[model samples]
Target: MNIFDIPAQAWAGQILIGLINGSFYAILSLGLAVIFGLLNIVNFAHGAFYMMGAMATWMLGNYLGLGYWASMLLAPLLVGLVGIVLERLFISRIYHLDHTYSMLLTYGMTLMIESLFRNAYGTSGLPYSAPVALQGGTNLGVLFMPNYRLWVVGAAVAVCLATWLLIEKTRLGAYLRAATENASMARALGINVPRMLTLTYGCGVGLAALAGVFAVPVYGANPAMGSDLLIVVFAVVAIGGMGSILGSIVTGLVLGLMEGLTKVVYPEASTTVVFVAMIIVLLVKPTGLFGESR
Candidate 1:
């Protein structure tokens, strides 16, 4: 094979890898968009919560004898509960204050959580194996694809679409949007705005935790793993438009594919491609591709 002639199979594999990464980006950015859109909170600690979810999965498996499937259900719930507590005890208090305060508070929380995990587990990652059933790959004529990766992509897509439908088409989502737009009017109409806010925050964190659970098997659980990816996720959110749910999903997948293509064509630019995309998007559309202009 000529040096410049990349095989079709190789391109397929790279695209698959890009899809997997994009799935993760979509999930993480979706969570951030939901939280920020509904609550107007930046949620700097989201990555930490993601780390906690992965950690929770590992711990559940090692200590509680839970399997991957069980941890899938339990870890997100646990992280979401923690989110509820955080919202009630700390985040809720900062709602009336400047946005900077919330950012600082979440940043501090991220540090504390990361530090705690680092002190306990060190900075190294703990391996989590894929479930026995999903350990192999399927041959798709042109390319062989891992079962676990396919699952990740499918699950992420289902989640993103379901969330969008819930928010855009459902009655409960309508109430949530109403509360987000005008809490006072929502409250006057007998809606419990506070409870909605609390649940929305938990839901956002739960989505992050769900991503973490899916990630542990692929990336392994590490103290700084979330932080390492957090910046990329932020870029995804920015490129997609901060509060635009559909934008987050599409931008994440596109950027992931772009990064994958960059890796094949110009490896040196892969790491910075997403940020570069963000800058370009900002230059062209300051409000973001899907974001409404303020």
Candidate 2:
């Protein structure tokens, strides 16, 4: 099959879809980057929290009669609060331990959370529709672009920028960065180290939850939704570099486009292309594309 024979519309459609997916990747990986970069926690349960965000949205809409906008606002806030609670109760206790312990604890938490959700939701997956206001598509010459998807991309971009600005520009961000580098020094200077750590973790979890909230309208609410996508998000983080914010954001968008191109050129290879790229990156620069050498 000649590449030239493929319709432009097909290419455009896939790329648009890829961009939407990349937006989700960017948000989710940003959260992972923050957690790992600042708190040094593995946070395998990030995915579980993500699932909770989506499920909580569905429950809010279904059980409480909350509309899309309300659910969207409430879900992440609720999930973030839960994250703060969990950090205070469990995560803070392990901060002094090796990273492996954190990973094991979070992974165990993932299993338990997924199990409870799966048992309750029963795997059929709850359906979520785009808000009525965004239920249409716009003609974009090459292909029709769904308004909801466009909104998703726009919203994700806003979230990413806000987070970047918060961490890189603000005074509070300086304190957070200082604490990340030296908790004892930060404490000596009158910064609340423990509180800062807890807030950082909560913020990371909140980002993941926000991604999940955006995702439900597009992907629907499934108990395994987070776990399934979690693998790819992890790859995005690794490819971007574990703790590099810009790396996570840039690599995610690039890989999403790469995935789209692969799907267009060779459908069979699309799924494995990310892992293949991940392997090459790991072999070439174990520190990651944007990671600084420690």
Candidate 3:
């Protein structure tokens, strides 16, 4: 390989990293978009919920000896049950209020949860190692790739697609959409609007939990992990415009790749690159690439 010529292996590795980041962005933003589309809540606590999911998995694996696969299945269910309780107890109280009210409520909830975790677990990051089954690296002639990274990308894509299909192609999805558009009409037509909303929230939170569970072994279950990533996800959603399911997915991966390219070209701007892109998008198209006026 020439000194100036691009190293194909390094390039492929960067793209793979970008794909993993994009997978996280896509799944997290999709969950946020889904809940917001129907409930009209900003879910400020989404990051906290994501962290809780990760923590739940770590704790389960620590105390109960649940493996990665079991944690993958159980973490979401537990976190989603918490979401249902939060929605029913606190979020439901402000359904008739302005969007700001729910936003503030969730924000407060986020702070409280963060504080609780700090008080209990402290601010230090905890390490969660990948399972033995996923511990090796694979050589694909061009580049050597970590198996866990491959698994993360695959799982995230599968979950995102499954959720999208559930919400777009099924009768339950039709009812959810109907309720989102007109709750009263949906109820009159025999749809259980409240139940639908509750389940929708649960599913949204469950998606976050899934993301968290997958992330723990890779990044470690930190108290502030979700808070940090949530900002990036928010930027992704802003640039993508949360208008359609597919748009969120595409924008996430595209932005992730863009970020990777930035790293290759301009290292200093990598951190703020997403926000900078968000600003450009807003200036050019306030409604975002896929968003519509409410």
After TM-score superposition, the amount by which residue 243's alpha carbon in candidate 2 deviates from its true location, in angstroms, is 0.6
Which one wins on lDDT?
1
The best candidate by TM-score is 2
lDDT tens digits by residue: candidate 3, 1-294:
343576777667678888989999999998888888778788888899899989998899889998988998999999999999999999978878998998899999999988988888998888898988999999978888889989999988898888889889999999999988999899999998889989999999998989999899889888888889998998888888854667677788888887776666666887888899999999999878888889
Cα lDDT listed for each candidate: 0.92, 0.91, 0.87
lDDT of 1: 0.92
Q: Give the runs in model 1 whose Cα sits over 4 Å from its true position.
A: 1-4
1-294, model 1: which lDDT tens digit per residue? 343788777777778889999999999999999999889899899999899999999999999989999999999999999999999999999887888998999999999999999999999899999899999999988888889989999999899999999999999999999988899999999999999999999999999999999999999999998899899999999988989999999998898888887787778998999999899999999889999974
Q: Estimate each model's TM-score.
A: 0.97, 0.98, 0.96
Best first by lDDT, ranked: 1, 2, 3
Model 1 weakest 10-residue run by lDDT: 1-10
Q: By TM-score, is 2 or 3 better?
A: 2
* lDDT score of residue 40 within candidate 2: 84
Query: Each model's RMSD to truth, in Å?
Result: 1.5, 1.0, 1.9
lDDT, candidate 1, at 285: 95
